[model samples]
Target: MSETQKSKPEIEAPQSPAPEALEIVDLVEGDGAEATPGATVDVHYLGVDYDSGEEFDSSWGRGQSIQFPLQGLIQGWQDGIPGMKVGGRRQLTVPPQLAYGPAGSGHPLGGKTLIFVIDLLGVK
Candidate 1:
């Protein structure tokens, strides 16, 4: 007896239009010190393409964290990250102007908006 195998269908991810302005949403406000400019911060972040909801980066999935000066990040991050305290979790919907700009990064992400959910672990 010869039988054919059945294949499951793949589901598409949700998409959103590019934001006109930066959107900041605080999921969990921490009780620690705020992340001021020039402060070194450790964070776990998930970055996705706003138009297609495609994941671009994630520190949590890597089972690791990143530490960098707050000012070193993009304008949206620099503006949004401040006031976020250690242990805080925030969602940032960044416009193209605040992200990689009209040129974007590369390929599919070009001239598109980006969304990032970041967790502030520590500040130094």
Candidate 2:
């Protein structure tokens, strides 16, 4: 298998009708503060494929979210969490531009939109 095929994250397409607008349910909205590029944040996330509604990954099962530096994440995450606040929840409909682009990173995600329900629990 090629490297591209290995890094892509597996995600099914969304089956539900696309909402006209995104609904954000913030459990803890960060203080409207900007997070540093390499800042570490702990959050609970539910990810579903935009076209399939199939769950791709979730931190909720673990009973808690995980923490990692924004810079250490994929482009989608690096760009997505900066605006969130502690205790904030947001539904992010990530386009291919903001997510895994044309040539997927080679895990299971092959150039697809990712819908994420993110709950910002805290920042370290």
Candidate 3:
């Protein structure tokens, strides 16, 4: 496989202004289907607390990609994940409001800025 095919997701923190809103950066530009609103997407992901660098959740660890409609996810995901092509990878830095809000999403998240490395596996 080529480097683009085997490259691991890079861990990165967004430079200023990222904490204020949703920040998205593409890591791999895929050559397949594009994500649109209401499209069903199959993806692998890793979620972490930005400030603490602690992993909060991951689909990669579960060995399965999840399929979900774009409209059913969080605001940041809804706004950010779209335009990604199948087989693409993205790094998103989401502020609390776009994430779980003040109450957080339960243990390990705590309403802080979140960092996610998402692999767009497929789109239908």
Candidate 4:
């Protein structure tokens, strides 16, 4: 067999399962209650590629959280953060539809399962 064919099984087998097939890991529960779509929130986050567990971005290294309008972010963020309260940490496994979609939207996130560890620091 060619090298490409031999390696294909090894690469595809492990990552074949869909993101939805994996369980979510919730680390902390927020105290201030859940967020809303238009709410501005301060959050510390780490984004990784679900299949690879590769670090994509992190706010914790900055020694501060970042703030953004929930509704303005990717569908994953908009849909995922509301149930989270201030001071809560949750993992989001976002399927491609809720993530960068097909074209990637400029970031390195396109047609992939995006994993996010989010800490909802505050609401403003």
User: For this target, which candidate reaches the highest TM-score against the unseen true structure?
Assistant: 3
Alpha-carbon RMSD to native, per candidate: 10.5, 9.8, 2.6, 11.4
Question: Compared with the true structure, what per-residue lDDT tens digits does model 2 show for residues 34-70?
Answer: 5556789876777887877778788865665688888
Model 3 weakest lDDT span, ten residues long: 1-10
In model 1, how large is the Cα lDDT of residue 82? Answer: 89
- Which structure is stronger by lDDT: 1 or 3? 3
If both were scored by lDDT, which would come out higher, candidate 2 or candidate 3? 3
Instruction: Flag regions of model 3 displaced more than 4 Å.
Output: 1-18, 103-110
lDDT of 3 at 102: 66
Question: lDDT of each prediction vs. the true structure?
Answer: 0.75, 0.64, 0.79, 0.69
Which lDDT tens digits does candidate 4 get at residues 77-100? 888887677767777778888888
Please report the candidate that would top lDDT against the real structure: 3
- Give per-model TM-scores: 0.81, 0.69, 0.84, 0.76
Judging by TM-score, tell me the better candidate of 2 and 3: 3
- lDDT for 116 (candidate 1): 86
lDDT of 1 at 42: 88
Better of 1 and 4 by TM-score: 1
